[model samples]
Target chain A: MEEFEPKIVAFCCHFCAYSAADLAGSMRLQYAPNIRIVEMPCSGTIDHRVLLKALEDGADGVFVAGCMEGDCHFLKGNYRAKRRVSHVKDLLRAIGLEPERLEMYNLSAAMGPRFAEIANEMTARVKGLGPSPFRKQTGGDA
Target chain B: MIVAEQKPLAEIAGMIGDCRKVLFAGCAGCVTVCLSGGEKETEVMATALRMKRQLEGNPLETVTYTATRQCDPEYVDAMADVVKGVDAVVSLACGVGPQYLAARYPDLWVIPAQNTTFAGGSKEHGVWEEFCGLCGQCVLHLTGGICPVIRCSKSILNGPCGGSQYGKCEIGKDVECAWHLIYERLKRLDRLDLMRQYREPKDWSKARDGGPRKVTREDVMIG
Candidate 1:
């Protein structure tokens, strides 16, 4: 049986994660192709609704990748993202979904290798969790 | 502003039993400001409900609409078109929002997604504290801005009751003594004389006592 290949949605900050992903490409860093990135002006712009919508649309896993601590391009945007991520994780748990399906990560634009590493890391983590419970149920609904 | 908290998912889900589709009505008024019900919350709830139901092998179809103010009949009327396509209506506003929806669409099932907590303002970013009791009487003029009715916990009219210790209510140190705050305010304003007069007992009939209260203003009456 082929191992489950999780569909991961990453809300990436344009100033950090997106830039790092581009850099990873320029550096020829290879990572899992399971991730579909949604670029935002700031990680803080990622609403709780956006994350939930991703899952409701059949994404196996979701994450917000932002700037490192105290390094948000828009001051406290990353911090706001962190708080929102925590809130969504709790919400997921309440809905009987694995909180592990949702996550928050911080990396600078200079971390090209780190960006690729995180993509591979999240892909592996979600793969271990298998297809999201909502996949079959929400696929047709979505 | 009216502060409200979202009801637990289990309770909300239970209230939606046997329904395959629902309309989530959100209000963009006080509830929006309090962060309980708004466009964002409306969408989030619809998504959550759909996913939860889907996981149970019972798919749910959801539609969301945010009215300007659910307490007003005009706003509730706007959701009429959306209500026609769903099995039930879930109001994300305070308690009044659901009542307004229910009254407007008598045949439709309306459920409240939030528990209306109180009339108050935010203390900080995410914390709200009750400031008004909606007793149909305004007494802020007599009590120096801070309301004793709701804040006092005991609703003591003439009190720093014996339970007041160090300006804190005996109920808990965290709770401020309403009378203590009143005295301090009147003192600062040099109006301590107002506190000297013996106060008469309030007329409770002005409140929600007469089996649902109404104030008719003929001047604003249409037709």
Candidate 2:
């Protein structure tokens, strides 16, 4: 049987993580290719619904990457992102999904190596967790 | 404003178990301002419920509608057509909204998604503090805009009980001494003399003790 390749969604802040991913490619860094990245103007733009939708859509894991603390170009975008990430994590756990399926990280735009490291780190974590339980059981009735 | 929190998803899920048709109702009043049950929140709840049901092998047919004010009879009446054939309604409004729906539509099962906490105002983003006790009286003018009844832990009428320390209440560091706030405002308004006058004991009969009180306006009465 083929190994379970978990579908992962990464919400990357344009100012930092997205640029970092670009830098990773420019630097010829090797990272897991299973994750699909969505670029947002700021990490704060990531809503709880987006994370929930990703899980509902059968993604094994989701994460938001923002600028380092106090380094957001929008001043407190990263702070808002942090609050949203925690909220979604709580919501997911309430529905029997492991909170570990969601993650929040902060890094600089120049950290190409760090972006690659995160990709590998999250991929390994999801592989160990198996598939999302939501992939099968719908909430109430059909 | 009113501050409320969402009920646990598991508890809410149980209420609508095996129900294919569902109504997700939102209130534009207190729940909306508190960021708990607004139009946007209704959409989110509808999506969450639908997705959850899909995961549980029970796909749901969900419909969402937010009223201008769920506490009003007219808005709830407007939902008559929308409620037809729906198995149950999950109200995202505050405590009043669900009761109103249940009262108006006795045949339809109404479930509350929010646990109403208290009458409060936003302290900051995602933070709210109780301000009005709804004691059936407004004495904000006497206190120089600071509410001693609600903000003060002890609900001291005259002044602080000498337990205030460093602008904080003696009972706990979290609670701010309401009298201190009143004193500062009076001093700034040059109405320090107002605080000197003694006040009589509050009339509890006019508050919660009144037992579902009601007021009528003669001028607005129909002949």
Candidate 3:
């Protein structure tokens, strides 16, 4: 049987995580291929509904990558994103989903290697959790 | 504003037991500002319910609608067409919202998705504090706009009692003694004399004591 390669969606902030991803690409950093990046205006704009929709639409794992704490381009955007991410985590847990399936990461534009590391880390974590129960039920895209 | 919070998803999900489809009705009134019920919340809740049921392999279907004010019949009436064919209506408004829905739709099973907490406003972003007990009486003038009936731990009309310490209620350090706030506020206004006026025992009949209260404004009635 082919082992489960979990599908991961990363909501990346343009100011930081998006730039970091670009840098990682420039540096030719190799990471897990299962992760898809959705560049957001700011992580603060990542809505709770959008995050849940990602999971419900069949993504095995979701993460919001924002600027470092107290270092958001919009001053408190990252802080807001952090609170929202935590709230969504609670929502995920309330629905019997493994809360670990979602995460919030803080990275700077300079953190190319860190971006690659996060992709690999998230991929491995989701792989460990296996295809999400939603995926297993519907045989959704892995 | 009436402040409220969403009930746990598990509890909400439990309310619809075995129902394959449901309509989530959200209010754009107080519950909206408090972020418990609104268009977005309605969508989010419906999505959550669908996903939960999907995971269980039952796959619940959902319809979403946001009323301008669920407490008002006109808005509740707006849910009329949308409520058809659904096994239940999950009202995301405050407690009053579900009651109104139930009253509007006889035979429709209406469930409340939020726990209506208090008559209050936001303290800050994401924080709401109860400020009024809705005792059906106004005492804000005497209390210097600080409601002793609700904010005071004992609801003492003439208080601060001996339980007040360092401006905090005996109940908790975080609870500001409502009477203390009243005293300070009145003192600042140079009306400390009002504090000693010897408030008579409040008339209980004017409040909830006589059962559910109503104000019939005859002037607003149309022939």
Candidate 4:
């Protein structure tokens, strides 16, 4: 059997995490290639549907990367995102999926190294968890 | 407005057992404002059901439709096209939605996905408390706008029932004694004298004891 390569979807706020990813690339950081970063206006804009859609479309894991606590460009966008992420986690668990498959992180735009670190960390965690049950049931690829 | 809560996913799944296709009908009325049933909840339910059934090796197809107001026959009639093909309909609206859908499509099976909890409004985001007992009477004027029929555990007309202590009801510490609240409010409004007036028993004829009720306005009737 081929080694499992998890597909991870990372929703990054444009004001922070997305910029951090760009900075990570500019700084020659080597992060996990498995992370697929999706840019949004703000982490708060990442709706529950978008997260669930990522999983339904074969993502092994999904995470939202937002601005550091109390530092959101929109004041409370990151806080709202935190609450929404928690709600989605509960929904995921109710559907029999591993709640750990989804996560939320906060970091500043200048934290390029942390961005790469999170990508690698999330990728490793998802790899350990293997493919999502939805992927397994649908006979999807690794 | 009516407040409702979605039934457990497991119970809903069991109710839809062996059905290959189901329609999830959502209401854009009170349930939407209450966050119980609406377009978002309907989609969430469909996704959850599809995921659950797929994992069990019995893939289920789900269609989602949201009516303007499920309690109205005209709005429910709008779903005729979509309702034709589904094996069953799982209404995410309050109890009224399923009954209306069932009435509209007599041949199709309609089931409720929510427990019609009460008529109330949200005290805050994601929290709702019962406010009306649907007793077919309005006594808020006499009670200083506080409803004792539903808010009070015992529905005492003249009470802080003997079990009331610290303004809380005996039934639960979390529940405030409704009569006490009414008294305080009336006191503040300088209508405390209303509390002393001997209250007559509530007339049950106007309530559910009279069976299913209807409100008609002859002036608004169409030819």
Best by TM-score: 3
Q: On residues B1-223, what C-alpha lDDT tens digit does candidate 3 reach at each position?
A: 9999889899999999779889999989999999989999899889888887887778899999999999888888877799999999999999998899888899899999998898999889889999988887788999899998889978889887999989998989998999988999999999988898888888777778878888899999879
By lDDT, the candidates rank as 3, 4, 1, 2
Ranking by DockQ: 3, 1, 4, 2
Model 1, which residues run further than 4 Å from truth? A136-142
DockQ, per model, reads 0.67, 0.37, 0.72, 0.53
RMSD of 1: 2.4
Residues B1-223, candidate 4: write the lDDT tens digits: 9999999888899999979999999999999999879999899889878877876779899999888999998899899998988999999999989999888888999889999999998899878999998988878998999998889888778877789889989989998999989989999999999999988998877888888887899999999
Q: Candidate 2 on A1-142: residue-level lDDT in tens?
A: 8686777889999999999999999999999987799999999888877888788777888999999999999999999999989987877666657889899999999999999999999999999998776654443211
- Residue-level lDDT tens digits of model 1 in A1-142: 8667788999999999999999999999999999998999999998998899888778999999999999998999999999999998888877778889999999999999999999999999999998887676433322
Off by more than 4 A, model 2: A136-142, B17-21, B46-61, B162-166, B217-223
When 2 and 4 are scored with lDDT, the better candidate is 4
Regions of candidate 4 where Cα sits further than 4 Å from its true position = A136-142
Docking class of 3: medium
Task: Give the range where candidate 2 chain A is weakest over 10 consecutive residues by summed lDDT.
Answer: A133-142
- Candidate 1's residue-wise lDDT over B58-129, tens digit each? 889989999999999988888889999688999998999889988899899999999999999999999999
DockQ of 3: 0.72
